[model samples]
Target: MKDMLIDDFQYTAQELLIRNKSILDLITKYQDSNSRVNRAIIKAVTQCGCMTISAHKQEIPDDASLDEMKTSVESHIEGLLCENCRDAIERDIGRNVFYLASICNALDLNLYDIILKENDRIRMLGKYNLR
Candidate 1:
């Protein structure tokens, strides 16, 4: 069977954008139809943050409470991204990822080390924030 690993594919931001041309086209197509599309993008990003946090902690999301998640996510989106700035959103996420990597490096936590530690913690203690 083929390897089901993300490592098999490599892409730059430009390449990724090119691959997702439909999204760009949709943004352009709906640009004049109010700011609903942009708002949706912001909403998706906020939901991503919440899901990532929940996933790290192995917390099963309450299906019945998704409306609450959406509300919290929207609030977070509003606080972090005002005026629906896509460029700012992209830059912030990129910078934050870089900062996290830098911190991990400074702490001598390589990829393997981090995975092992996380596994151990998950088994023994539990999933808490790294900091």
Candidate 2:
């Protein structure tokens, strides 16, 4: 299984999902249907923030007044969600990207390159109505 901490581990998509299955399930169980969709995106941003903090070995001070951790978790995952249902599409996108990246890394594929290429292709051949 690929370790999120390291870049060297090889993990298949199914394997990685199985490892983080609890988080996915938690999102579904705790959040409403709308939130469920965006949960993945929220998780992505959260994971990115967590990874940066971990990399810098930053710690929340005991005297810290604000819940920085909580804020970080909610960044880019609150306002854009469905107003009526509170779904976080950003979080969902992030989660999907993170998962895809891990799997691609395992397969020795370039994540950024693939993303850019696909994005360009989509722009060139837009089909579906955005809303």
Candidate 3:
């Protein structure tokens, strides 16, 4: 597998965000279920202040119902989001996955190897200096 620079990964992430709608559509169609994607979406959305990471941590009033809490989360995500930023975040997630896959293929290693041998992996990653 070919090596990818960190810059390339960053660039790809940006590109993915720019094409956010397309990525969402694909996710809807494919039902792709990966936690990283979910995390990236949350990270991007939170970064844009569409919602706070600690929204759930807020104290709920005794009068508030479960439905209200759910609604609050939805409203936070949908009501205040920056469309451009959200799109970009989705793209960043896709780019990250692509980068990881490329590295795995190049090294003939699996995800377990990368996670378990992170220091070695980082050293290998250091080989591809930024262009």
Best by lDDT: 3
Question: In candidate 2, what are the lDDT values of residues 5-54, reduced to their tens digit?
Answer: 23332233435554444545534433444455654444534643322112
lDDT of 3 by residue, 1-131 (tens): 22345445534544544333354443542334355567656765556556554344555567866666545443333454467756766676655565554444434445544555776766776634311
Whole-model lDDT, candidate 1? 0.41
Per-candidate TM-score against the hidden true structure: 0.27, 0.31, 0.30
Which regions in candidate 1 have their CA more than 4 angstroms from the true location? 1-84, 111-131
lDDT score for residue 65 of model 3: 66
Over 4 Å off, model 3: 1-48, 55-80, 109-131
Clashing pairs in 2: 34-87, 38-88, 40-91, 40-92, 41-90, 41-91, 41-92, 42-91
- Location of the lowest summed lDDT over 10 successive residues in candidate 2: 72-81
Of the candidates numbered 1 and 2, which has the greater TM-score value? 2
Pick the TM-score winner: 2
Query: How far out, in Å, is residue 74 in model 3?
Result: 12
| Model 1 quality (TM-score) | 0.27
Count clashing pairs, candidate 3: 5
In order, candidate lDDTs are 0.41, 0.46, 0.51
The candidate, 2 or 3, that scores higher on lDDT is 3
